[model samples]
Target: MLFNSSGFLFLYLPFVLAGYALLARVRPRWATGWLALVSLFFYGYWNVRYLPLLMASILFNYWVAGRMLAAVAARRRRWLVFALAANLALLGYYKYANFFIGSVNALTGAHLQAWEVLLPIGISFFTFTQIAFLVDCYRGLAGEYRLVHYTLFVSYFPHLIAGPVLHHKEMMPQFERPPGLNAADMAVGLSIFVVGLAKKVLLADPLSTLAGPVFAVDAHPQLVEAWIGALAYAFQLYFDFSGYSDMAIGLSRLFGVKLPLNFNSPYQAANIAEFWRRWHMTLSRFLRDYLYVPLGGNRHGRYRNLMLTMLLGGLWHGAGWSFVVWGGLHGVYLVMHHGWGALAGQGPPRCWGRMLTFFAVLAAWVVFRAPDLSTAGDILHAMVGGNGVALPHGLEAYASYFPVGCSFEGIRWIDFSGVAMPALLLAMVLAFAAPNTQQIFRHYAPCIEQLLGTPSCLLWSWCPHSYWGLAFSMLFLACVFSMNRVSEFLYFQF
Candidate 1:
């Protein structure tokens, strides 16, 4: 069930939270078991058919960890390899089977029938979490925990779908601790949740309308059309994914679990490297420590390692060539960033870096959002003025001086009279200038703080006084009004 849905926000969540809170106070062991069960139920709420698959995955990983821990040196390595292969094989079959079959059919005239393998929600996240767990176990960095704790760590409802990608060491200990509801934490959690819900319903979904028309264009868009669509999508993705991350953090906090920070203000980042550090942070950490480090990292050919990690990372997102191109472009951006740093001996000015980084990301988002290479090329061509510029009919005299393709009343999709451009401008301001959810809630230490480092950009802090309470009350009311059209978080596809 989507966190934004009324069923979850109203009925399921209240019942589960109340039960968990009471159980934690009375029977600690039962609290843990109860949470694990409800978490499983939450996953099942999406698709009951996949419940067994999730359980099987949990059981398999737990057993693999056990076997790996019990073995000798070579045996442990062997078990680790076996477990990794098994986990990957399952993921590949489910996530990539159709793509593989389709590609083969296109290339060699082979009519390979694609199998009907429905990908389980959060498969990528849970698989990666378990893989990291098994690797840490092999390296003696992680300890074996009880089955219930392991189950909860994997199945926890907050980060289960679109995730911050929980680490075992970060989560398991919390489940092992005695459960008691904290009033301060609960308040912080509700406030964060309300803010996130507002973002998703109010900003992200509406912007999707602008982005939708632009992407739906059958051919190259006009210059203005391209920018409108691109900018609209850039912010739509920012709020959609960012909103989900905030809700995840807030929901986990309600259970007294502080999930690692996921969505910082990535757009404010002055460089591509800094962007990665800010966006989808736990996934970046996993890729760095698990994939990049294992592939020789910078100890060998740094550029080559970057390409490989990003390529695989892109593939991990989906089974499509568009994703590969998106990943490949980021790989190039990182190489240029590092290459520039090495030669210049210092970074670019903050303003220059921030603008350049944003444009670079904007270009990459076109590819990421496109259905294929052809569509991406069309959009990029238009973005570079291959299509022409569109101006209002009254500006004909001014348009004649341009010495380029200029047309009046060329737009057929974007509606400026509506909330399109206004909302986009608002989003741009909020993204670049505003403090993020973590910053606004920094005073409460609502999320894991050390990873985000010191709060260097706090415009304001949250206060628990009546003024703030009334403001949040109106914000919450606005959130409820916007919830009339509930939608799924964008990251769920990954």
Candidate 2:
């Protein structure tokens, strides 16, 4: 279930939180078990059939890890290898079977029929999590697995779908600790969730309104529309994915788990190399540890390492040529940036390099977002002065699908475009100029220290932290209003 939905926000969350908190003081073990059961229910709430798949995978991995750990025979390494392969085989069959078949059919002109396999939600995430666990077990890095902890690790609903990819070490301890409700921490969690909600529903969805029409043009429209769409999409994706990440982080925090931060305002990067370091950082980390480092990393030839790393990284996103090309393009950009930096003997300062890097990355996102090579070419052609026609008259038809107004005549003079402009500009400034809102608030560490230190504030149970109280109330109201129009999270398909 979506984190921002009404059923989740009002019904599921409140009921679950109350149930969990109520059980925590009296029965901590039962509380965790209940959480796992609730999480399973949450998963089943989406599609009941998929629930068995999730449980089977979890149970399979748990058994495999235990078997691999208990093995004493020298030849039994093969069993561990077999188990790892089986886990990967499950992932490969379910996620990549059709993709592989389609590729084979396309390349060889063999009339191979692609199998219709329905991808289970969060399969990619759970697959990776389990694979990592099995690898750790074989390596003797993890201790004996417990059923309760293993179940909780796999089924925790907060980061279940799109993830920061929790490691066993990160999650196990939290399950060991009591899952009590801390009012101070709970308030912080709710605030972050609301902010994330606003980022997705309010800002990201409206930006899509502008972005959708421009991209719908088969040929590019005016340079104005082209830039608007490209820039708008760049921001739209930032807020959308980052919004989901924020919600994931926030939700995890409520349960007293600290997920790794996903986005660091990647648009602020001074170079493509830096951009990758900032964007979808967990995925980058996964590639570095699991893929890039294993593929000889930069320890070998610098250029080869960069290319291979990016190529595999691209392939990891999907089994498509476009994704491969997108990865290759970034790979090339990084190589060029590195070569240039070496020649100059230093990197550019944050401001100048960041703007150039933002534009370079923005240009590349056009390729990433385009449907295929031809569409990407068309977009690039338009960007470089391909004389395309004006946008069609009914371009604003879908604008009314959102809460935003369509035309100036039926609505107030302020159009949807006008309404979103201020938010758009604010997002741009935040993307470029400031540290993220979190880092900015973190600057107030000393004031927070003094307030808690004060004699008068301690006695009252109802006293709220001023900044959090103000910010989250505004965010909560905004998210409530924003969700009145439904918008899909950008990463849902992936």
Which one wins on lDDT?
1
Model 2 residue 468 CA deviation (Å) reads 4.2
Report the lDDT tens digits of candidate 2 across residue range 1-494. Answer: 78878889899988888888889988877888877888899888888999999999888888878787888757347766887788778878877898889889989999898888887778777777777777677778888756988898888888778776778887887788877876455545665676678888877887876677666637454554567677778899899888888888777777777777788888878788889889988777776777677678777777777888888667666667767888898889889998998899778887889888888888878877776767776766766656342333455665655434223223211124465666777778767776774674454322334335554332111233445444556667778876876766877656
lDDT of 2 at 456: 38
Write out the backbone clash pairs for model 2: none
- Model 2's alpha-carbon lDDT is 0.74
Off by over 4 Å in 1: 217-219, 393-404, 444-464
C-alpha displacement of 106 in model 1, angstroms? Answer: 2.0
**In candidate 2, what residue range of length 10 has the lowest lDDT sum?**
405-414
TM-score of 1: 0.94
lDDT of 1 at 186: 73
TM-score to native of every candidate shown = 0.94, 0.87
Candidate lDDT (C-alpha), each: 0.86, 0.74
RMSD of each: 4.8, 6.3
